[model samples]
Target: MESSVFFENSEKKKKAIGIIHRVYLSQLKNSRKYLASTKTKSEIRGGGRKPWKQKGTGRARAGSIRSPLFVGGGVIFGPKPRLVYKKINKKERKLATISALFLKEKQLVLVNENEFLNFDQIETKLICQLLSKFELEEQKKILFILPKPNKKFWLSSRNLKNVEVTTVTCLNLKQLLKASHIILSKESFDLIKLTYGQQ
Candidate 1:
Protein backbone atom coordinates (compact mmCIF):
# COMPACT_ATOMS: atom_id res chain seq x y z
CA MET A 1 0.00 0.00 0.00
CA GLU A 2 1.95 2.99 -1.24
CA SER A 3 0.82 6.23 0.47
CA SER A 4 1.79 8.29 -2.55
CA VAL A 5 -1.25 6.97 -4.41
CA PHE A 6 -4.81 7.76 -3.35
CA PHE A 7 -8.36 6.59 -4.05
CA GLU A 8 -10.59 8.99 -5.90
CA ASN A 9 -13.74 10.11 -4.19
CA SER A 10 -15.96 8.45 -6.75
CA GLU A 11 -13.83 5.84 -8.46
CA LYS A 12 -11.96 3.12 -6.63
CA LYS A 13 -8.37 2.58 -7.81
CA LYS A 14 -8.74 5.73 -9.88
CA LYS A 15 -6.00 7.24 -7.73
CA ALA A 16 -6.45 10.60 -6.06
CA ILE A 17 -3.86 12.95 -7.49
CA GLY A 18 -3.24 14.96 -4.33
CA ILE A 19 -2.18 14.29 -0.76
CA ILE A 20 -4.24 15.11 2.34
CA HIS A 21 -3.39 16.09 5.92
CA ARG A 22 -5.30 17.11 9.02
CA VAL A 23 -3.88 20.32 10.40
CA TYR A 24 -4.67 23.89 11.35
CA LEU A 25 -3.46 27.35 10.34
CA SER A 26 -2.16 27.98 13.85
CA GLN A 27 0.32 25.14 13.42
CA LEU A 28 2.02 27.27 10.82
CA LYS A 29 4.12 30.18 12.07
CA ASN A 30 5.30 33.08 10.00
CA SER A 31 9.00 32.38 9.49
CA ARG A 32 9.92 35.44 7.46
CA LYS A 33 10.14 39.14 8.27
CA TYR A 34 10.18 42.03 5.84
CA LEU A 35 12.51 44.00 8.15
CA ALA A 36 15.42 41.74 8.95
CA SER A 37 19.23 41.47 9.04
CA THR A 38 20.00 45.18 8.75
CA LYS A 39 23.67 46.07 8.58
CA THR A 40 24.94 48.10 11.57
CA LYS A 41 26.61 50.39 9.04
CA SER A 42 24.99 49.98 5.67
CA GLU A 43 26.85 53.01 4.34
CA ILE A 44 24.25 55.69 4.98
CA ARG A 45 26.72 58.27 6.24
CA GLY A 46 25.32 61.69 7.22
CA GLY A 47 25.76 61.83 11.00
CA GLY A 48 28.55 64.45 11.23
CA ARG A 49 27.83 67.88 12.77
CA LYS A 50 27.41 68.74 16.45
CA PRO A 51 24.57 71.08 15.42
CA TRP A 52 24.82 74.58 17.12
CA LYS A 53 26.82 75.59 20.23
CA GLN A 54 26.36 73.31 23.26
CA LYS A 55 25.74 76.25 25.65
CA GLY A 56 24.15 79.02 23.55
CA THR A 57 20.91 77.87 21.97
CA GLY A 58 17.69 77.69 24.03
CA ARG A 59 16.88 74.38 22.26
CA ALA A 60 18.01 71.20 24.01
CA ARG A 61 21.57 70.14 23.28
CA ALA A 62 21.79 67.93 20.23
CA GLY A 63 23.97 64.85 19.95
CA SER A 64 25.06 62.56 17.11
CA ILE A 65 23.41 62.99 13.73
CA ARG A 66 22.48 59.36 14.09
CA SER A 67 20.06 60.31 16.82
CA PRO A 68 16.57 59.15 16.10
CA LEU A 69 15.04 62.55 16.85
CA PHE A 70 16.71 64.35 14.00
CA VAL A 71 15.47 64.27 10.46
CA GLY A 72 17.30 61.74 8.26
CA GLY A 73 18.71 60.38 11.48
CA GLY A 74 19.24 56.68 12.12
CA VAL A 75 15.99 54.91 12.72
CA ILE A 76 14.88 54.44 16.31
CA PHE A 77 13.43 51.07 17.28
CA GLY A 78 13.34 50.59 13.55
CA PRO A 79 14.21 47.52 11.55
CA LYS A 80 17.78 46.60 12.47
CA PRO A 81 20.36 43.83 12.51
CA ARG A 82 17.97 41.16 13.62
CA LEU A 83 16.75 37.93 12.07
CA VAL A 84 13.01 38.23 11.46
CA TYR A 85 12.58 34.69 10.32
CA LYS A 86 10.48 32.67 12.78
CA LYS A 87 10.83 28.94 12.76
CA ILE A 88 7.79 26.71 12.68
CA ASN A 89 8.70 23.25 13.84
CA LYS A 90 9.12 20.81 10.95
CA LYS A 91 6.08 18.87 12.14
CA GLU A 92 3.99 22.03 12.38
CA ARG A 93 4.98 23.25 8.94
CA LYS A 94 4.17 19.84 7.52
CA LEU A 95 0.89 19.91 9.38
CA ALA A 96 -0.03 23.27 7.91
CA THR A 97 0.92 22.08 4.44
CA ILE A 98 -1.19 19.02 5.01
CA SER A 99 -4.11 21.19 6.00
CA ALA A 100 -3.63 23.18 2.81
CA LEU A 101 -3.47 20.00 0.77
CA PHE A 102 -6.62 18.71 2.40
CA LEU A 103 -8.38 21.77 1.12
CA LYS A 104 -7.09 20.84 -2.31
CA GLU A 105 -8.45 17.36 -1.88
CA LYS A 106 -11.96 18.78 -1.56
CA GLN A 107 -11.41 20.67 -4.84
CA LEU A 108 -11.04 24.06 -3.15
CA VAL A 109 -7.44 23.86 -4.28
CA LEU A 110 -7.30 22.90 -7.93
CA VAL A 111 -4.76 20.21 -8.60
CA ASN A 112 -3.42 20.12 -12.09
CA GLU A 113 -1.58 16.86 -11.78
CA ASN A 114 -1.27 16.88 -15.54
CA GLU A 115 0.62 20.19 -15.55
CA PHE A 116 4.41 20.07 -15.48
CA LEU A 117 7.80 21.76 -16.05
CA ASN A 118 7.05 23.24 -19.44
CA PHE A 119 4.88 26.25 -20.20
CA ASP A 120 1.93 26.13 -22.52
CA GLN A 121 -0.78 28.66 -23.32
CA ILE A 122 -2.97 25.68 -23.90
CA GLU A 123 -2.20 24.72 -20.36
CA THR A 124 -3.85 27.93 -19.25
CA LYS A 125 -6.72 27.16 -21.51
CA LEU A 126 -7.03 23.75 -19.99
CA ILE A 127 -6.87 25.23 -16.52
CA CYS A 128 -9.58 27.68 -17.46
CA GLN A 129 -11.60 24.79 -18.74
CA LEU A 130 -11.27 23.07 -15.39
CA LEU A 131 -12.28 26.25 -13.64
CA SER A 132 -15.22 26.62 -15.95
CA LYS A 133 -16.28 23.09 -15.20
CA PHE A 134 -16.08 23.84 -11.50
CA GLU A 135 -17.49 27.36 -11.85
CA LEU A 136 -14.29 28.85 -10.45
CA GLU A 137 -13.60 31.57 -13.02
CA GLU A 138 -15.22 34.28 -10.90
CA GLN A 139 -12.94 33.64 -7.95
CA LYS A 140 -11.51 36.95 -6.72
CA LYS A 141 -8.24 35.44 -5.62
CA ILE A 142 -6.55 32.49 -7.23
CA LEU A 143 -3.07 31.54 -6.01
CA PHE A 144 -0.73 29.23 -7.77
CA ILE A 145 1.71 27.16 -5.76
CA LEU A 146 4.70 26.82 -8.05
CA PRO A 147 7.45 24.27 -7.51
CA LYS A 148 10.21 26.63 -8.51
CA PRO A 149 11.05 29.57 -10.71
CA ASN A 150 9.86 29.02 -14.23
CA LYS A 151 9.70 31.97 -16.58
CA LYS A 152 6.98 30.40 -18.64
CA PHE A 153 4.80 29.76 -15.64
CA TRP A 154 5.46 33.23 -14.25
CA LEU A 155 4.34 34.79 -17.51
CA SER A 156 1.24 32.67 -17.80
CA SER A 157 -0.56 34.43 -14.96
CA ARG A 158 1.11 37.84 -14.90
CA ASN A 159 -1.60 39.37 -17.05
CA LEU A 160 -4.28 38.45 -14.56
CA LYS A 161 -3.95 40.89 -11.69
CA ASN A 162 -6.10 38.86 -9.33
CA VAL A 163 -4.03 35.77 -9.87
CA GLU A 164 -1.13 35.52 -7.43
CA VAL A 165 1.77 33.12 -7.86
CA THR A 166 4.30 31.78 -5.39
CA THR A 167 6.60 28.83 -4.81
CA VAL A 168 5.92 26.10 -2.26
CA THR A 169 9.07 27.05 -0.34
CA CYS A 170 7.76 30.61 -0.16
CA LEU A 171 4.28 29.75 0.99
CA ASN A 172 2.74 32.39 3.25
CA LEU A 173 -0.33 31.79 5.39
CA LYS A 174 -1.93 35.11 4.63
CA GLN A 175 -1.55 34.62 0.91
CA LEU A 176 -2.78 31.07 1.09
CA LEU A 177 -6.02 32.02 2.82
CA LYS A 178 -6.51 35.25 0.89
CA ALA A 179 -7.14 33.31 -2.29
CA SER A 180 -10.38 31.52 -2.95
CA HIS A 181 -8.60 29.08 -5.18
CA ILE A 182 -5.21 27.41 -5.28
CA ILE A 183 -3.58 25.82 -8.31
CA LEU A 184 -1.07 23.10 -7.62
CA SER A 185 1.43 21.72 -10.05
CA LYS A 186 2.24 18.02 -9.73
CA GLU A 187 5.92 18.40 -8.95
CA SER A 188 5.42 21.00 -6.24
CA PHE A 189 2.71 18.95 -4.59
CA ASP A 190 4.97 15.91 -4.49
CA LEU A 191 7.79 17.93 -3.05
CA ILE A 192 5.58 19.03 -0.18
CA LYS A 193 4.52 15.47 0.50
CA LEU A 194 8.10 14.30 0.41
CA THR A 195 9.02 16.99 2.88
CA TYR A 196 7.05 15.20 5.60
CA GLY A 197 7.27 11.66 4.24
CA GLN A 198 3.53 11.84 4.80
CA GLN A 199 3.03 10.04 1.54
Candidate 2:
Protein backbone atom coordinates (compact mmCIF):
# COMPACT_ATOMS: atom_id res chain seq x y z
CA MET A 1 0.00 0.00 0.00
CA GLU A 2 1.01 3.65 -0.23
CA SER A 3 3.13 5.02 2.66
CA SER A 4 3.03 8.71 1.84
CA VAL A 5 0.30 9.44 4.37
CA PHE A 6 1.08 12.95 5.48
CA PHE A 7 -0.56 14.43 8.56
CA GLU A 8 -2.77 16.67 6.42
CA ASN A 9 -3.62 14.07 3.76
CA SER A 10 -4.11 11.00 5.99
CA GLU A 11 -7.63 9.61 6.15
CA LYS A 12 -9.15 8.63 9.51
CA LYS A 13 -8.30 4.93 9.19
CA LYS A 14 -5.12 5.59 7.24
CA LYS A 15 -3.81 7.72 10.09
CA ALA A 16 -2.95 4.50 11.91
CA ILE A 17 0.20 2.68 12.84
CA GLY A 18 1.37 -0.27 10.74
CA ILE A 19 2.55 -3.53 12.25
CA ILE A 20 4.87 -5.85 10.32
CA HIS A 21 7.06 -7.79 12.74
CA ARG A 22 8.83 -10.11 10.30
CA VAL A 23 9.66 -7.29 7.90
CA TYR A 24 10.94 -5.25 10.79
CA LEU A 25 13.00 -8.14 12.19
CA SER A 26 14.48 -9.07 8.80
CA GLN A 27 15.62 -5.49 8.28
CA LEU A 28 17.41 -5.55 11.64
CA LYS A 29 19.14 -8.83 10.77
CA ASN A 30 20.34 -7.55 7.40
CA SER A 31 22.07 -4.59 9.06
CA ARG A 32 24.26 -6.72 11.31
CA LYS A 33 27.90 -7.20 10.15
CA TYR A 34 29.72 -10.25 11.46
CA LEU A 35 33.48 -9.88 12.16
CA ALA A 36 34.37 -13.35 13.45
CA SER A 37 36.78 -14.10 10.57
CA THR A 38 38.87 -10.90 10.62
CA LYS A 39 42.63 -11.37 10.78
CA THR A 40 45.38 -9.07 12.14
CA LYS A 41 49.17 -9.15 12.45
CA SER A 42 50.68 -9.00 15.90
CA GLU A 43 52.85 -6.05 16.86
CA ILE A 44 56.61 -6.68 16.85
CA ARG A 45 57.96 -7.63 20.27
CA GLY A 46 61.54 -8.69 19.60
CA GLY A 47 63.83 -10.33 17.03
CA GLY A 48 67.50 -10.79 17.77
CA ARG A 49 70.35 -12.29 15.73
CA LYS A 50 70.69 -16.03 15.24
CA PRO A 51 71.50 -17.90 18.47
CA TRP A 52 73.70 -20.34 16.55
CA LYS A 53 74.25 -21.80 13.07
CA GLN A 54 71.27 -23.30 11.19
CA LYS A 55 72.42 -26.91 11.87
CA GLY A 56 75.00 -26.54 14.65
CA THR A 57 72.46 -26.08 17.46
CA GLY A 58 70.69 -28.99 19.19
CA ARG A 59 67.45 -27.05 19.21
CA ALA A 60 64.60 -27.25 16.64
CA ARG A 61 66.52 -24.92 14.35
CA ALA A 62 69.29 -22.28 14.52
CA GLY A 63 68.06 -19.28 12.60
CA SER A 64 67.43 -15.53 12.98
CA ILE A 65 63.70 -16.19 12.78
CA ARG A 66 61.74 -13.53 14.61
CA SER A 67 58.70 -15.80 14.98
CA PRO A 68 60.66 -18.45 16.89
CA LEU A 69 62.66 -16.19 19.21
CA PHE A 70 60.01 -13.63 20.20
CA VAL A 71 57.21 -14.53 22.62
CA GLY A 72 54.98 -11.88 20.93
CA GLY A 73 55.15 -13.45 17.48
CA GLY A 74 52.73 -12.41 14.75
CA VAL A 75 49.30 -13.84 15.26
CA ILE A 76 48.19 -16.41 12.73
CA PHE A 77 44.71 -14.86 12.68
CA GLY A 78 43.01 -12.14 14.71
CA PRO A 79 40.38 -9.47 14.43
CA LYS A 80 41.19 -6.47 12.21
CA PRO A 81 39.47 -3.26 11.14
CA ARG A 82 36.89 -4.46 8.64
CA LEU A 83 33.53 -3.25 7.40
CA VAL A 84 31.21 -3.78 10.38
CA TYR A 85 28.07 -2.17 9.00
CA LYS A 86 25.96 -4.54 6.89
CA LYS A 87 23.31 -3.55 4.38
CA ILE A 88 19.55 -3.52 4.95
CA ASN A 89 16.73 -3.17 2.47
CA LYS A 90 15.42 0.38 2.54
CA LYS A 91 11.81 -0.81 2.32
CA GLU A 92 12.44 -3.20 5.20
CA ARG A 93 13.96 -0.47 7.36
CA LYS A 94 10.93 1.75 6.80
CA LEU A 95 8.53 -1.09 7.53
CA ALA A 96 10.36 -1.99 10.75
CA THR A 97 10.01 1.56 12.04
CA ILE A 98 6.34 1.44 11.07
CA SER A 99 6.05 -1.65 13.29
CA ALA A 100 7.72 0.28 16.09
CA LEU A 101 5.28 3.10 15.49
CA PHE A 102 2.49 0.58 15.91
CA LEU A 103 3.93 -0.40 19.28
CA LYS A 104 4.13 3.29 20.13
CA GLU A 105 0.41 3.60 19.54
CA LYS A 106 -0.30 0.89 22.09
CA GLN A 107 1.24 2.78 25.03
CA LEU A 108 4.54 0.95 24.56
CA VAL A 109 6.58 4.08 23.90
CA LEU A 110 6.96 7.35 25.80
CA VAL A 111 7.57 10.73 24.21
CA ASN A 112 8.85 13.49 26.44
CA GLU A 113 7.97 16.93 25.16
CA ASN A 114 9.23 18.98 28.11
CA GLU A 115 12.87 19.87 28.29
CA PHE A 116 14.88 18.54 31.23
CA LEU A 117 15.78 21.23 33.73
CA ASN A 118 17.03 20.03 37.13
CA PHE A 119 19.25 16.99 36.52
CA ASP A 120 22.00 17.41 39.07
CA GLN A 121 20.79 14.36 41.04
CA ILE A 122 20.21 10.78 39.87
CA GLU A 123 16.91 11.76 38.33
CA THR A 124 15.85 8.13 38.59
CA LYS A 125 13.11 9.24 40.95
CA LEU A 126 11.77 11.70 38.40
CA ILE A 127 12.07 9.19 35.55
CA CYS A 128 10.61 6.54 37.82
CA GLN A 129 7.73 8.84 38.57
CA LEU A 130 7.19 9.45 34.90
CA LEU A 131 7.22 5.73 34.10
CA SER A 132 5.10 4.81 37.12
CA LYS A 133 2.47 7.33 36.12
CA PHE A 134 2.35 5.65 32.75
CA GLU A 135 2.36 2.17 34.30
CA LEU A 136 5.69 1.39 32.63
CA GLU A 137 7.83 0.85 35.72
CA GLU A 138 8.06 -2.89 35.07
CA GLN A 139 9.54 -2.41 31.61
CA LYS A 140 13.28 -2.77 32.11
CA LYS A 141 15.09 -1.77 28.93
CA ILE A 142 14.18 1.76 27.94
CA LEU A 143 15.84 3.48 25.00
CA PHE A 144 16.00 7.26 24.99
CA ILE A 145 16.65 9.04 21.70
CA LEU A 146 17.68 12.67 21.78
CA PRO A 147 19.26 15.09 19.36
CA LYS A 148 21.94 15.18 22.04
CA PRO A 149 21.88 14.44 25.72
CA ASN A 150 22.03 17.24 28.26
CA LYS A 151 25.00 16.64 30.54
CA LYS A 152 22.83 16.42 33.63
CA PHE A 153 20.48 13.88 32.03
CA TRP A 154 23.42 11.80 30.86
CA LEU A 155 24.96 11.79 34.32
CA SER A 156 21.64 10.89 35.93
CA SER A 157 21.07 7.92 33.66
CA ARG A 158 24.64 6.80 33.10
CA ASN A 159 24.64 4.74 36.29
CA LEU A 160 21.77 2.62 35.04
CA LYS A 161 23.33 0.66 32.22
CA ASN A 162 19.98 -0.73 31.12
CA VAL A 163 18.64 2.74 30.35
CA GLU A 164 20.33 3.39 27.01
CA VAL A 165 20.61 6.89 25.57
CA THR A 166 21.64 7.79 22.03
CA THR A 167 21.33 10.59 19.54
CA VAL A 168 18.49 10.45 17.06
CA THR A 169 21.04 10.58 14.25
CA CYS A 170 23.15 7.81 15.78
CA LEU A 171 20.33 5.44 16.71
CA ASN A 172 21.54 1.85 17.12
CA LEU A 173 19.72 -0.80 15.10
CA LYS A 174 20.45 -3.43 17.74
CA GLN A 175 19.39 -1.35 20.74
CA LEU A 176 16.13 -0.32 19.10
CA LEU A 177 15.22 -3.96 18.64
CA LYS A 178 16.18 -4.91 22.21
CA ALA A 179 14.49 -2.01 24.02
CA SER A 180 11.17 -2.87 25.66
CA HIS A 181 10.27 0.78 25.76
CA ILE A 182 11.45 3.52 23.39
CA ILE A 183 11.47 7.10 24.64
CA LEU A 184 12.06 10.06 22.38
CA SER A 185 11.68 13.77 22.85
CA LYS A 186 9.23 15.68 20.69
CA GLU A 187 12.14 17.40 18.94
CA SER A 188 14.02 14.13 18.58
CA PHE A 189 11.06 12.36 16.98
CA ASP A 190 10.55 15.23 14.61
CA LEU A 191 14.22 15.12 13.74
CA ILE A 192 13.97 11.40 12.97
CA LYS A 193 10.96 11.89 10.76
CA LEU A 194 12.68 14.77 9.04
CA THR A 195 15.81 12.72 8.39
CA TYR A 196 14.30 9.35 7.34
CA GLY A 197 10.62 9.97 6.65
CA GLN A 198 8.88 12.02 3.97
CA GLN A 199 9.32 15.79 3.90
Per-model lDDT = 0.57, 0.57
For residues 1-199, write the lDDT of model 1, one tens digit per residue: 2323543343432222121112223323244445563322224486566777788779888756656676666654556544444445665555555554554454445456555354655345544554566567745788778787666666666666777778878776566656777777667777767664552
Tens-digit lDDT string for candidate 2 (1-199): 1233432444532423332445445556666676565322225544466656777466777444445244444556565545554456675566455444433543345455664544556676666665676666544888777676666677667767577777766665566667878776667767776665642
lDDT at position 144, candidate 2: 71
Show model 1 residue runs off by greater than 4 Å.
1-83, 103-112, 115-118, 121-130, 146-149, 167-170, 185-191
| Model 1 accuracy (lDDT, Cα) | 0.57
What TM-scores do the predictions have?
0.48, 0.53
- Which parts of model 2 are misplaced by more than 4 Å? 1-61, 65-108, 115-122
Q: Sum up the clashes in candidate 1.
A: 1
Model 2, global lDDT: 0.57
